[model samples]
Each structure stands twice: as C-alpha cells, then as structure tokens.
Target: MKILVTGANGFLGRNLVEQLRNQGYDELLLCDRNTSESELEQFSQEAEFVYHLAGVNRPKKETEFIKGNTEFTEKLLHLLNENPNNPAVMFASSVQAELSNPYGESKKKAESFVQAYGEKNQTPVAIYRFPNLFGKWCKPNYNSVIATFCHNIARDIPVQVNNTETELTVAYIDDVVKELISLLEKSSFNETSVLYEITPTYKVKLGELVNLINTFKESRNDLSVPQLNQNLTKKMYSTYLSYLPEDDFSYDLTMHVDDRGSFTEFIRTPDRGQLSVNISKPGIVKGNHWHHTKNEKFLVVSGQGVIRFRKIGSDNIIEYFVSERKLEVVDIPVGYTHNIENLGESNMVTLMWVNEPFDSQHPDTYYTEV
Candidate 1:
C-alpha cells in the first residue's frame, strides 16, 4: 500500500515509518519540514493512506502554530480531495486540543478540518488525541519531559522539577505505532465519534518518575538492575538507555581476584536477587561459609566440581558432583556450611544466583568447615 506520512522525521513519524518498513511497507511517502509543497501534492495523489502527523507544538511565534498546524492541514486535505482515489486518513492530534491555548486551538482547528473533509469526500479518517509520548529517538530538551529527564540524568546533569507532584498520562511509542497499524487494518469507527483512543497507557507522578530515572543512572557503579516486573519502570528504563551516549553503553565490574580464582557480581536488585560468576582453579576450593537467611543456586558451566554441604550442628555431609558435561543446579540451604572443590585439570566457571544481595554491614555469612 502506498502510505504518505507527513512529519516523517518527527518522533512519532520516525518510529511509525521504521516499524511500517519492518512490516513490509515499501512505498512510503515521507515528508519532513523541509519537503516542498509540490512534492507533498504529488505524493498525496499517489498515496492510498495518509498519516497527517505534521503539526507545530513548540514554535518561535504563536501565529506559526496556526500556520503549521491548521493552514498546512487544510492544504494537505485540499490536495487529497483533488485526487480520484479517496485514501484513508489518520491525524496525530493531542489531548490538549480541548484547551484554549494557542497550540490547542491550532490542533482543534486542524482536527475539525480533517473531520469535515472526511465527511464531505466520504473518506475514512482516524484522529488520535495522544498523551505524553516517550520512547527512543525522541528529541531531548523539547516537548517531551521524559526525553529531557533521560538525556540529562544519563549525562550526570541535574534535572529541575518544578512540580514533582504533578501527574501525567504517558504512552510508549511502540504502543502508539501498534494502534496506528491496527487502525489501518480495521478502519472501523463510529460515525458519531471520529476520535480514536489507544489503550494500555501508564500514569506516573513527576517526582517518582525522576527518582526512577536517577536510579537508572546510578546502576552503572552499583551493578544493579531495575525491577522489571513493574510495567512502567521496565519501559521507562528501556527508554532511558536509548538516550545514553554512544560510548557509554557498557560499564566494567570489579572482579575479586586471588590465587584461587575470581568472583564477580554481575547484577543486583532489591527484591529479585543477585547474579554472580565464580572461577576456581584446578584443585582449588572456594566458599567455606554458611548464611542465616540467604540461599543460593550454583550452576557449573565449565570443568568438574564437587559441592559439599553440612548442617551447622551436624556431622552429616551431602556431596553433589557437578560438571560441564551435564547442566545441573545445586541449591545451598540456609544454616548449612558449603564449599565447591574444582576436581578437573583446568579452571572451573560457575554461575551463582543468590536470593539476596551481599551486604558488608551485616554479612549474614559465617565461616565454617564443610
């Protein structure tokens, strides 16, 4: 299908175009702010569908809002009406259009024009009043508060929040794009209401949002990962990572090295648990320790090893033979002293997951013989 997308370089336009191409759309008529009117007219004539995304939200002059939003939309509709083919139209309107501000007035006028054109020409149209949108490739320091916060916080710059208690309804860019695709496929709507609403939006407090973003920035040195079970935090963290500087994608972790081998912590979370890697040289043993409340699962990924565990007050010892030949997990129970001895000729690598992160202040660990 030939689809024309105005403001193709804008935040929503870029994401929509990229995803459309991924879904096997080849004939896309992309128009940005620099595209000439003559070119837009030609593209509109050839397009089977139109995504009218071009609009001015932040402009140098107030009057430019009407010119960019209302006047431009009027011209695009006029060109589409001249074409013999009546293509389906979709407009990226905003929830602010119901307000009395200049920007809102412009969007309101543009939305009215599109609806009128759709009724007169009998062309199908979809107008979306989006909330605060956030995702990758969004321009920082403009329009989107989430984008600005992510960019600034990642760079170690302080962010200023005037009303930290202010709440906002936000939508992820992927969700917006998915809804657009659905609109194209179904093209179903009620004649009474021309508005199209997207589902699964998230509501966040401004202060909480900033705090979550700050945690993402601090994860570099802390070797911690955010709690992804919360839907909003997961998406927010992903969006934050997308704005990181090119050279700062990776960070190194400190490995505790000794003659026996090395142990490195990879990730830690408050409630989810922690992951660490342990290396033991041949004939070397590590971890003659027992904990009061912590439990661990150890998986031998390389070489052969024997994990021996003994109850704190008992002489009975349980031995589990582990090797790279067969993957198996050994659990270290609470109040039990445990140790792993490398039995192979080469070094052994083990992946360990503990239910709780290690703390130096109150290290529940107590040294004992296994």
Candidate 2:
C-alpha cells in the first residue's frame, strides 16, 4: 500500500515510517517541511492512506500554529479530495485540544476538517488524542516533560518541578507506533470512528517520576540495575540511555586485584543476585571458600582451569577439568568448599554468578582449603 506520512522527520513520524519499511511497505510518501508543493500534490493523488502528523507544537509565534496546522491540513485534504482513491485519514490530535489556547484551537479546527472530509467522501478516518509521549529520538526541553527530564537527568543537569503532586499521563512511542501501524492495515477497528484512544498509558506523579529518573543516574556508581518489571520504568530507562552523552558510553568498574588476579563486579541485582568477572594469572588459584546459604556458577571462558570441591568435614576431593575450547559451567553447591586453579600457561578468565550480592556484614562465605 502507498502510505503518505507528513512530518516524516519528526519523532513519531520517523518511528512509524521505520516500522512501515521494516514491514515491507516500500511505497512511502515522506513529506517534510522542505517537501515541494508539486510533490505533495502527486503524493496526495497516489497515496492509499494518509498519516497527517505535521503540526506546530512549540512555534515561536502563536500565529504559526494555524498556518502550520489547520491551514496545512485543509490544503492536504483538498489535494486528496481531487483524487479517485479517497484515501483513509488518520489525524494525530492532542488532549490539549479541549482547551481554548491557540495551539489547541488549531488542532481542534484541523480535527473538524478531517472528520468532515471523511464524512463527505465516506472514507476511513480516525482522530487520536494522544497524551504526553516519551521515547528515544524525542527532542528534550520542548513540551514533553518526560523527554526533558530524561535528557537533563542523564547529563547531570538540574530539573525543576513546579508541583510535587502534579500528575502526568504518558504513552511510550513504541506503543503509539504499534497502534498507528495496526490502524493502517485492512483489519482496522471502526474505520469511520471519529475518536480513538491508545492503550497502556502510564500515570505518574511529578515527585515520583523525578525520583525514579534520579535513581537511574545513581545506578552507575552503585552498580545496581534498575527494576524493569514495570513498563513505565522500562521505557524511561531506555529513553534515559538514549540521551546520554556520546563520550559517556562506557563506565569504570571497581576491580579487586591481587597476586592471584583481578575480580570485578559486572552487574548487581537486588533479587537476581550478582555477576562478576574473575581473572587468574598462570599458576594461580582462587576461590577457596564455602557458603551456607549461597550458591554460585562459574564459567571458564579463557585458558584452562581446574575446579576442586570437598565437603566441609569430608576428605574426598572431586575435580573437574575445564578449558576455553569447551565452554562449560560448574555449579558451586552449598556445604562444599570450592576452588579454581589456572592450569594453562596463559591467564584464566571466568564469569561468576552468585545467588546473592556480597555483603560485608553477612558475607555467608567461609574460607577452607579445597
């Protein structure tokens, strides 16, 4: 199908167009601010569907709202009216349309035009009133607080909250794009519907939102992974990472080094325990310890190593030979003292996952010769 997308360079427009291309919709009429009138005329005639996403959200002059929004929408509909296809229209409106401001008034007017054109031509039409939206590629510090907060906080910039109790309804850009793509397919819902709402919107308070974003910044130093079980947090975390400065992609981890080698914590989770990397030099041995309630899995990824195990009070010793040539995991069972020794001429590197994070007060580990 030939789909025409206005504001094709915008956040939502870019996301929607990318998915369309991925889904094999090769015939796309991408109309940006610089698109010529003659080209738009040709696109309007050839398009089978129109995503009217072009609009002015934060124009410097208030008069530009009507020029970019209402007037432009009328012109597009006029061009499409002359075509034989009578293509379906999907209008992206805002919740602020209910207000009397200039931006809202312009959107309200554009919505009226789309509805009338659909009624007169008897073509598919839908008007979606979106709430605040956030995701990667959204510009920061304009109208979206979520984007602004995510961008500013990721860079250690101060964020101001006007009211602690201020609540916001936000939608993830991926969700919105998914919904829009579904609407374009032949299996659409209520083709002539005047109003449609997207699902899975998150409502968050200003104070709580600020606190959640702050924790993401603090996670680097604490080595604590933020909880992503919730959708809002998952989306916010993704958006936050996208706003990070290009030069700040990597972070330094604290490494405990000794004659044996170096041990560094890779990831720390509250419920999922911890992951660490252990490096041992040639002829070096590490991890002569036993745990009561803790368990671990060690995977040797480089060089050759030997793992030895013995019960706390037992004398029988069990040994397992491991090498980088054959990747394997050795589980450390409770009540068994364990140790890994480098058997190769080169250094041995292993990845370790423990059942719980290491706590100085309750280490749960007891050193023993294995």
Model 2 has an lDDT value of 0.92
Candidate 2's clash total is 0
Q: Please provide TM-scores, in order, for all candidate models, with all chains considered together.
A: 0.92, 0.97
lDDT of 1: 0.92
Error in Å for residue 232 of model 2: 0.8
lDDT of 1 by residue, 1-370 (tens): 8999999999999999999999999999999988997899899899888999989999999999999999999999999998788888999999999899999999999999999989988878889999999999999999999999999999988899999999999999998998887766643655677898878799998999999999998998898888888888899999999999999998899999999999999999889889999999999999899998999999999999999999989999999999999999999999999999999999999999999898899889999988
Query: Once superposed on the true structure, which residue ranges of model 2 sit more than 4 Å away at CA?
Result: none
Write out the backbone clash pairs for model 2: none
> What lDDT would each prediction earn against the true structure?
0.92, 0.92
Q: How many residue pairs clash in each candidate?
A: 0, 0
TM-score of 2: 0.97
